[model samples]
Target: MNMSTMNSACPGPFVRRHNPCGHRTGQWAQILATTTAQDQEHFLVIYHDSDTELLPAEAPEQHYEFGPAPAYWTE
Candidate 1:
């Protein structure tokens, strides 16, 4: 899925693998932002620990699993 085209105004839940930050590499996070760069999509996300990170929407080492945000994740 091309996340750069996704609606950033309404963030959703996503699971990432092999996170470069080396924390919670395979966990669900809330996507706070999505942007395009060099024809590639990136995602800025916040984890359960409140830690935020910017990751590629797709990469050789990282995998993204996107889904709807949980009920508890509300404004």
Candidate 2:
């Protein structure tokens, strides 16, 4: 299969390193999916500690902060 098809079929997790409020709490999060609720988009993410949180999709860079995972992260 083509790269695009493969990616679409099994998209990699959207990972970020921070809290919902855009603060670095020494945690890494993986965005699982996006859902709409009450006319707003939200992201379903799970932290490295196995804690799940729903974050606003608007201005994701600010709400669900994004950055490289810490060196300790391992898949």
Candidate 3:
């Protein structure tokens, strides 16, 4: 795929650097700024030494309650 383009989808030159750690099926994400919206996707720098965290796109506003559902965050 060609990088450094004028678009909104693939912001900037996004590249994933795979760091091998004596195993497979693990990877990280990194981002390098550039003059393009596609560049934002490259902000997540993945490293082997660092632990990557994945969160939901957006947190649920109203959590359904089921018989005193587990409470947290001052629920």
Candidate 4:
């Protein structure tokens, strides 16, 4: 996906990204502010369009791999 940033007359730079699943789907979001909720730091991003939605962000410590797969001839 391609991301673009606008340098308009705003406090923070406006960021926009296109949805990879849809050709004409895209969204623009800006970092409105930052605050701590329940002792966890969070960023407040406002979306200008409804083409996309936001999910709860998480910080994963490390990546784990699934074990080796078994080989089977027939299904």
How much does each candidate deviate from the true structure in C-alpha RMSD? 5.3, 7.0, 14.4, 16.3
Q: How far is candidate 2 from the true structure (C-alpha RMSD, Å)?
A: 7.0
lDDT score for candidate 1 against the true structure? 0.61
The C-alpha lDDT values of all candidates are 0.61, 0.52, 0.26, 0.32
Please write out the lDDT profile of model 2 over residues 1-75, one tens digit for every residue.
222222311223545534435543445566666666687766677766677776565644443335454565433
lDDT by residue (1-75, candidate 1, tens digit) is: 554345532366554555446556667678776777678776778876798876766652235555676544322
The per-prediction tally of clashing pairs is 0, 0, 12, 0
| Ranking 2 against 4 by TM-score, winner | 2
> Once model 3 is optimally superposed onto the true structure by TM-score, how far is the C-alpha of residue 68 displaced, in angstroms?
33
Q: What TM-score would each prediction reach against the true structure?
A: 0.56, 0.53, 0.19, 0.34
RMSD in angstroms between candidate 1 and the native structure over all alpha carbons = 5.3
Question: Model 1: residues >4 Å from true position, as ranges?
Answer: 1-10, 18-21, 36-40, 59-62, 70-75
The residue-level lDDT of candidate 1 at 10 comes to 35
> Residue 22 of candidate 4: its Cα lDDT?
26
Residue 12 miss distance in model 4 (angstroms): 1.3
